[model samples]
Target: MAASPDTLARVEELTARRLNRTLLARQHLLARSTQTAHDLIHHLVAVQAQESNAPYISLWTRLEAFEKDDLTALLADRRAVRSSILRGTQHIATDDDYPWLRPTVQPVLDRGRQGAFGRVTAGVDPVELAALARKHLTGQTLTRPALARLLAERWPDVEPLALGWSAQCLLPVVHPPPSGTWGRFGATPFVLAEEWLGRPMAAPDAERLVVRYLAAFGPGSARDVQAWSGLTRLREVLERLPLRRYRTPAGVVLYDLPDAPLADEDAPAPVRLVPEFDNLLLAHADRTRVIADAHRRVVITGAVVRPTFLVDGFVRGMWSMTGAGIVLAPFEAITEAARDALTREAAELLRFAGTEGSVSFTAPGH
Candidate 1:
């Protein structure tokens, strides 16, 4: 049975470490899940895919036995899709989730278009542009540049880049396979979502969006949901939902599904090599649960969230793959135990990446 709102109102106060453990459990970072790549993508609602290899690396770290082919096959089979959704950025969502998820987050895309191309698209009919874009993208895929030129032919006065981006934000278009496939890289191409998936998008539902967000990245505040989805005014929506609430040590109210399990604050956390643009680092407004403010500044630099290694469930350093192999750059010195753990995790990452190289470390902050 669901807990009554009255029962839920006696809010529990969650310590920061408690929030950290719960987040790790929900994200499957405390332990790699046995779930398949497709199901994990759906449960996540969307996997950040700004970098072509990001989704692959993200899944590799979270799944028990994930291979590059595990996700590559999904894109090839049309069971997964890559498009702009959460925060108006590139993400790979399951075919079933995209139909509804895209619509739910459409407002964010619309707002992005206005902020980016509203002035450039002045005096241009957005509805007409969207229709024409859909028509061009109906049965065939076109690269962004090609689509831009085509749209410019109709509105000769507008900037081609603006026109292309405007169309992208206005229409539910997707980048087909090879666009987001592992080890693949190139200019992004688009096809109408309906044409690509052979299904129409469902109507937007903010309520469902909130529930999914909490499931994956929860015990979060309204601000966190808004931050993650790039949609605002969620507090009202949150108030109407049947979620249980808790207070942070700072007195901030956090909402979660009534049945959701909270991990014990003392639960052990393994070292993890989180990928760049991974949603785990971007999902919450108050990121201190998973990363310290000082470490965050080093990990996130003006739109780029560098790949990081976690120690004791918190970010301890940044890492990257180089010709020399995996390089670990810690912000501060780590204990010998943490160093040994990171070394082992790094070796596994190399094997998963299918690369031959040695793992090296630099002095703190180097």
Candidate 2:
């Protein structure tokens, strides 16, 4: 006989529970790791920022010995930078990452600006405008309004908001420190990422980026990556990657690195308080792994991503800082033991925040 037509079986299946714990471990949510702030930022690729103090708290919640000074030093020293990239939102990324990250995501920003802001900035040469924007921002830090007003002087006919937002969308800009400092609010300043970091923007390499996404948030589908990054048409990139593929019992294809960690289905998941816009919660197309179907809308609104906590590697509820203390609102009731764990962690968070805050709870569905 020539040969058996049937080949050896392939690819392990990943249950939602296993997926949850694996992701938690990769993100350092199960337990705080000792990775330096710079290394963590580089590994995670970026932290969802723009909300002051979110980045600092994010590091604190994920790094064992994290302190405010750890992150503040990176921003002050320019080893890291804050800028708009994935999904065109403000994020803090290391100098090593942004060069490649910014170029890769430029098309996403272009599409967003063209579809939304371009309607108002119609007929403006974006190429020329980008050049002018870079020129205006070179060796200078200008707030949005100031930069807008200056650019508007030349194109007085265009809406100043459009002109300003165009520069924001089109440029690889950084809002340096004292800007992201907790509780400090004023003019939001911008500088070119290349100038601030002294590294040129890297060429777009979609293949490598797909691998990075897999490393950080993987065993996920292309749609998950698209949902996380807000970049579309990534199927080609995913297809080209040398990925180890798996499927859920439901048959959803999941991709991963050949050696990526996939934890046991029964692994324990500790409670972790994450800041608003935590990328872990935002990284999947099917987030039922980390969030329930009914509770998703409650966590995210139009532009606001609420701070949330994970119980057993899933978003058990939401939390917030109030005048009196940290408030925990569970979507479902928890055991006394879980409640006690949350209370202890809340105190740690309060101390990290330099607050005399206490923990308060509300009934499920309240």
- Among these predictions, the greatest lDDT belongs to 1
Give per-residue CA lDDT, model 1, range 36-112, as digits (tens).
99999988999999998889989988999999999989988889999999999999999999999999888999999
Model 2 vs. true fold: TM: 0.96
lDDT of model 1 at residue 48? 95
TM-score to true structure, per model? 0.97, 0.96
lDDT of each: 0.91, 0.86
Decoy 1 TM-score against native: 0.97
Candidate 2 lowest-lDDT run of ten:
1-10
Superposed by TM-score, candidate 1 places the C-alpha of residue 55 at a distance from the truth, in angstroms, of: 0.8
**Across residues 112-206, which tens digit of lDDT does each residue of candidate 2 receive?**
89987878888799988989999999989999899999999889999888888899899888888788777767888988888888878889978
